[model samples]
Target chain A: MAKNKRDGTFYINPYLGGVLLGLVLFGTYYITGRGLGASGAVKSSVVSAVHTIAPVHAEGNKYYSKFLSDDASPMSNWLVFEVIGVIVGGFLSGTLYGRLKFIVEHSPKITGRTRLIAALAGGILFGVGSQFARGCTSGAALSGMAVLSASGIITMMAIFGSAYLFSWIFKKLWI
Target chain B: MVGPLIPMGVIPETWNNVIALLLGVGFGFSLEASGFSSSRKIMGTFFGYDFVVLRVFFTAAITAMTGIFYFDYMGWMDASMLYINPYYVMSAIIGGIIMGFGFALGGFCPGTSFTGVAIGKIDAMFFSGGLFIGVFIFSELYPLFQGLYNSHNLGGAKIYELLGMRDTVFAFLLIVVAVGMFYGAAFVEKKVTKVEY
Candidate 1:
């Protein structure tokens, strides 16, 4: 099992990685009755930040108030903790593969600035879209599909289908 | 005892966050180890240069679905107890289309962006920041989008039921389709010229 290639970096085979990921997702459902998530944590952080900066305003808002509680901080949620674990796990993997470098990855044709701007724009769109759809790729799509949920399957197709269509429009950014 | 330990009370509520942390670690490790930390690598799926995203994604979906079926069949878990995102016809499709546009432009999704941040990718940091701003925007403008967001709710509908098929039958067909796509992806990858980031 060649761990490292000649370039001082290594990656697991995709299929094997998929199996491991599948088992992890299965464990999540077995134990927590919920699927994995990433954007939810960011939503939590946003709620917490708003609560801290404007307690009254946050409490008054419809969305923020839905997550607010008298006994617990908004940040003290399961998704937040899971995201922290994601960071730790990612760091560990990076260390193992010798890829823990501070660099901006982009296509050679695009400037780092261009990539950053696009990334930011994309993130904003994803954040808004996730809220509307009730979950992102991990939460609504992957998790939903695991249980054969209609919304999950539909959302998954929409995301992939739209991406395939838009990728051509944004071809200059990648290829 | 039926599985989904938390709901079944097999695992106490206090351990929920702890379990979450452990599961997240596995999720994160698998993603980063499979080159998901690189946005370009992920975008490869869209361009047909690399099919890793499709391969890993479909494989994991099938594996988890299969596990759920097996567990339920063996009486180890109650499939009915699992949480399902409710179906909102318009919102789901509209939101997904927007996300797809974002994905191509940003080259990273929420989960993958976190992996990028962990590996110290500056673009990922900006992308995460963008997420916070986007959420804030949505929260502030909730009233304007409230109707669209709340309309056409189907309430946790299952795909098999919607299609008037058995769960086992649906699962079997999904697996067959996934395997066929896997082969097709391999063929496409061979034809497309590899693009290095």
Candidate 2:
């Protein structure tokens, strides 16, 4: 493996990384009959939290009730387990690359508070959109693209297209 | 002999979780190694300073699509059984636009944020924390959005079918487009000013 000038900055080629990701995605479908997902786990977590706080409320809500069942906990969902794997996988990558370090990352022009605020707002929009679209960027856009799903392609275009437009609007936040 | 191992029974249900873990590992590794752990690098796709996201994303999409199609042709997997995402046009477009807003503002999406969190990025942690809150909000307000959410349900619709073309033809065209974008990205990368994270 080639090393970068800075420690823990080494990375594989983008094309190679893409091929590897493709295989992982292919493997996922082959074994689980599904593609990869990240946000769905977060949704599960949210559902579980609501269920714990107000079982009645959770059951009353059509969306929450749909996911709620006596046979298994919401936390025991496939996406939940997969997310756990993501954490472990990410940890392993960080450990191997020696990149594990606790810190806040932001543009030089912005304060940590500003970044955090943006992050929170972004999460909220993403959360709402994922529900509306039936998945997040990973679950909807990427996975959808793999299977040539119209929703996936449209969602992918919308997200990236909107981001490109908004990025210019919020250029100060990043650049 | 193509697609969706579950319907064909080529892959047992029992091993699903284990496979998830292994795939997750690869997913994480590729993401982190591609510098996705850094917010600036990811944001660079919009700035034109770096096209890593564009390069990696389209490459992965085309690669997987082609691989699956090829395997189907080789009599390896049953493509007919493969699961395609259901199309809900209005919901998809609206949801995507909203999610894009989040991407530009949040500097991290669910998947990349996990990679960042793995590297001990506090911002990533907060972004994920926000996801929990956001999802909670959605679930709580489900009644208000239920109509839109379930408004349109096209079951596992394929893009090619909708476009009035064969799947192979669409896939082939996509490959050409992706290759063109790859070259375009390289050219843009060279022209844009480099931003240090």
Candidate 3:
């Protein structure tokens, strides 16, 4: 079987990758007056979809209504467009580096089904957490840290701290 | 002229979305290039085999923090206009802890998962589907969680203010800390038994 192009070997130096990521983040803040975000776009999409299908239900909800406005669809917001660019930019990078492929990435110890199940469950938890926190890792934690926000610092520490313990419990799943 | 472009009008409002797309391109390119698109590579941090997450995250944070301070000193941008994450102390920490567990299990955050999707990872696609479902769930249940979510508001508080330190001092300390962690990551990567993914 052919190996996954991105999985087989050679990754760029970590520090160089860091520098590049830093520059991107800095650029994001400089231009937008805000940092990069990912989960918010998904939240917006969900709100839009819910509103479309069940406007009454959406309007009745406290969470969905905060994002809704009479002048514009929540789905048409900046984060949504930025997320679209993320897909495009990521694809371009993969193509450029020969890293695009179809495969299920998992620990050798687990079946693809198990990995997928875990992935789904994890995503759900992340989704809920991000909504409550007002942002996900990229949006709340990382971006917040960039501006030295107190919330950002707290979130960053909590995430790494919690994940360290959780990762140990799930050791068999990864290593 | 010490920070945000849009609010300060250093850049016009019309360019916001356009610049957002361009900035996102840069953001996506960086994440993909850093191997964030791969679940195994991302999970490597938790396993002690790879520390890319720590490296990229801290470096980016410290770099941007320093740059913002520098720009403020130089009067290139208005730092005050930039958005800071509001400090809802309990909610932020609790939410982070939950997100952390999700990350350890799922191996992809929302942004990286999108990158994974771009590279045709069906698992990422599923993860994103789950994200939407989870968001919907949260929205529906917002009344139950609203109190916790909005609790203990600190109103865009800064770490420097909290610590009663000069902004530059805080920023410098962060750089030093990031550098130390980078070295630590290198050391650990060398010591750990190599896990081929």
Query: What's model 3's overall lDDT?
Result: 0.84
Which runs in model 3 stand beyond 4 Å of their true positions? Answer: A1-8, A70-76, B1-3
Cα misplacement distance, residue A161 of candidate 1 (Å) = 0.8
Query: Can you write out model 2's per-residue Cα lDDT over B1-197, one digit (the tens) per residue?
Result: 34466556666667666766777888888888777888888999999997888888888888888878887788887767666778887888989998999999987888888888888988888888888888888888888888888877887888888899998899999999999999999998999989988
**TM-scores of all candidate predictions against the true structure:** 0.96, 0.95, 0.95
Question: What is the TM-score (0 to 1) of chain A in model 2?
Answer: 0.91
Over A1-175, each residue of candidate 1 has an lDDT whose tens digit, in order, gives: 3444424257788999989889999988988887888888888889889999999999999888987763284224888889988888888888888788789888888899999999999999999988888889998899999999999999999999999999899998888
Q: Which pairs of residues collide in model 2?
A: B1-B77, B2-B77, B2-B78, B2-B79, B3-B77, B3-B78, B3-B79
* lDDT (tens digit, per residue) of candidate 2 on A19-39: 877787877766555678888
Q: Of the pair 2 and 3, which is ahead by lDDT?
A: 3
**Model 2 chain A lDDT-worst window of ten:** A69-78
Candidate 3 lDDT for residue A71:
19
Judging by TM-score, tell me the better candidate of 1 and 2. Answer: 1
DockQ: the better of candidates 1 and 2: 1
What is every candidate's C-alpha DockQ against the true complex, given to 2 decimals? 0.81, 0.73, 0.73
Expressed as tens digits, the lDDT of each residue in B62-84 for candidate 1 is 99999999999999999899988
Candidate 1, pairs of clashing residues: none
- Model 3 TM-score relative to the real fold: 0.95
